[model samples]
Target: MQSSYLLTLLLFAVNAFAVSLPIRIVSWNVRFDADASTRQDGEKPWSTILCGIWSERCRKPHVIELLKNEAANTASPTIIGLQEVLDNQLEDIKGGLGSTWQHIGFGRDDGKKAGEYSPILYNTDALTLVFSEMKWLSPTPDEVSFGWGAGSRRVVTIGVFEHKATGKRFIHANTHLDNVSSEARSEGIKVVASRIKAVREQFGPLGATLTGDFNSEPNQDAYQTLEDMDFLTEVSKSEAVKIRNLDLTYTGFESEAGFSRIDFVWFGPTEQHFYAAQSWEVVNNVVDGVFISDHRLVVADLTAL
Candidate 1:
């Protein structure tokens, strides 16, 4: 009996000696709720057109429930990077996620409550927010404006977090690249990559993880541009592709046949990676016969090295 007790204590001691606890980071692009006249095929409005006749409550609940269930799946701390979130939708999600959740990022339009936000949501009980900032995906990143012939303004939200369990610090940046111009998508990721250097200069070599909808595929210019940066490595392209994802992250609503793989979860400074990828999952978008979002969420489990 003493031998068994000693073995259990040894295991716990080893785990406690680790630098940082394992964390789950989720990246998703929830489709925006378009105007009544602008709704596309297979795309459903967030609210019901006919309130009483609709079978389910609304699209909002499924999205809320999805995050809630995802958070409950593991005891480890969780943080999420989301794209295509409007001001009102942010309010809905924050309220639905309850008091334990907090986020860092603002709307992309006026830098307040105007447009879409590539927000990073974190669990307050597990991590402390050290610093947070939102920057445009432009040569002049400090200004909130369009760049590289992009139709709309794009932005990235970067946050430094301290793991409460281990007292270690790391960075998380989130963004949504342009879907219209390939040039914009290409330049946008470069700006996001540059933030890595800026972050290191200020924070001094903390590991950085980025989650976003690149819009560019693995073969595209933007993905290649970021790859050439060399320090920030994509997890899916690495040997850590331990578990195969059944479907691509972007579903495009009801189309079961043609989803694209645009969403990504990445960890960096390849030489001194803080979080090593353990497993990857492209979570299903559909629930109870309803699609939660046009794009499915991607979750990655990262363990401290």
Candidate 2:
């Protein structure tokens, strides 16, 4: 009788633990909508690197499949932040993923359909979108104008989500900084931090995750600004790399190892929420010689404490 009672207690504990699973958030730059028909000058030489011989338009299907698998594996559905996505590409992603998935964000050009978008996609079944907004990385963030030394208009997509089963809430922000201007990249992060703080103030204490393709290296001023703030921490710092492969995030379809690690998945305001960094991976989605994007998706698994 005592053994039976002990078994029941153990089972209950296990079940309780299983109910509180960590959320999986992914950050990927889908390389925009540059297919065969729309191939530019730079992509011409790299045509041979694709999976299907002379097939430059098949990456969307692979990307969709990868996202589907991510959603299937996690108990607490996956939230994806995508950059460099055009309007048509967004439609393709949404159609491929089905109605269960929904996204929030707008075009950077006019907040409509002019420029690329840095959008966030969530599983509607597992998460409820409480609030969402888009802010530009400019001095006058409210207006659709570029600031600092930006070459083009850049914006950040912010979403506050609540877990359907657990009622747990968190904030997710995604962006892509200016590629050419160092001033833009540096000032852009500061703007992001301010926005994150504002959202936290409005939504109460919530764990935050910021993901993006910064287009700057770790040692640059932009990264240093984030470090100096001491609020956010890169997820890659905690994980022990299994394979010391090319750390570059932007491969550009070349075999060269000189590319910088520009992509990142960050979680923090560590003092507010205890974040246990689980694993970090630079997913090489180049299957059978086909590349998913020029940039590898940087995925991190984290548990909020």
Candidate 3:
């Protein structure tokens, strides 16, 4: 489906004098770089360069370009949470975003370089890492294991960050709920929320943001359960909030393949927290001709309350 961008940022740009309480957050599930045999019709294998060194058919360059543009507005310090990222793809993103960007979280399978990472990337010039950790979404969260009949191991990357400019701190947690098991998705998010609360008890009272490809819609168990959570405030789904679009976030590569809203960004443990979402937008996933990822990323501006 079609989409638009943030008019708030545009106004910030044109007027230079616009009040900028710019703490921008993004949630995306960049489809894992897969083997050609498994590649679908609308999908392209990832590449690091342009052709001889990089080919036009490659998707990594495009992915990097999309991120670069997203992080372009420096006045708003950006924090990006990405899912389905292989270790190599993470490196490509780091390199593309350059030295000013830094990230946290390790692979879920081995806690090393073995599996996918739902990593949190931020601009170093804007934010300082206070604390971070990665935990499996299983009963044995401290160990590498699967949970609730899930097909594979899943993990949540949690980080506490301080805005260098204002000394404001916020917690950000990122994860991808399992697609194969409804029980896993449902139980896994409770694990995620408990972890965030644990973080808050240790370092909060400060505002917190959770970004992820939940794989479950608002009416579904996972999303609804999280909303039922007293500590968290749903931004993208809240009727009280004026969001630019509640459009489907996952396009499944082809327009006709699949359409759904399974991604979200939230703030908590109470709406009274310092971070109040100001503007929210579901960014267009298509760049030029290729879908940047199977899902459209969500962007939001938060004011420090």
TM-score for all predictions? 0.89, 0.85, 0.88
lDDT of 3 by residue, 115-227 (tens): 89999999898889999988899898999999999988999999998776656677899999999999999899999998988988998476788899998988998998898
lDDT of 1 by residue, 36-154 (tens): 69766666677675634663535787888898888889887888999999988888888989898899999899999889999999988989999999999988888889979888899
The digit string of per-residue lDDT tens for model 2 on 1-305 reads 99999998778644533444487778888887765787643443222346355444357667777777766766756889999988987887887788988999999999988789999998898889999999999998988989788898999999998777666678999999999799999999999999999999998777899999998888987788887899898876755242335567887754444377888888888565546677777777564465667787777777765
Q: In order, what lDDT does every prediction score?
A: 0.83, 0.79, 0.82
Best by lDDT: 1
Model 2, runs deviating above 4 Å: 1-21, 35-57, 239-246, 256-258
Model 3 weakest lDDT span, ten residues long: 12-21
**Better structure of 1 and 3 per lDDT:** 1
Report the error of model 3 at residue 116, Å. 0.7
Error of 1 at 164 (Å): 1.6
Task: Give the winner by lDDT: 2 or 3.
Answer: 3
Model 1 residue 172 lDDT? Answer: 91
Point out the higher-scoring one by TM-score: 1 or 2.
Answer: 1
Pairs that collide, model 1:
none
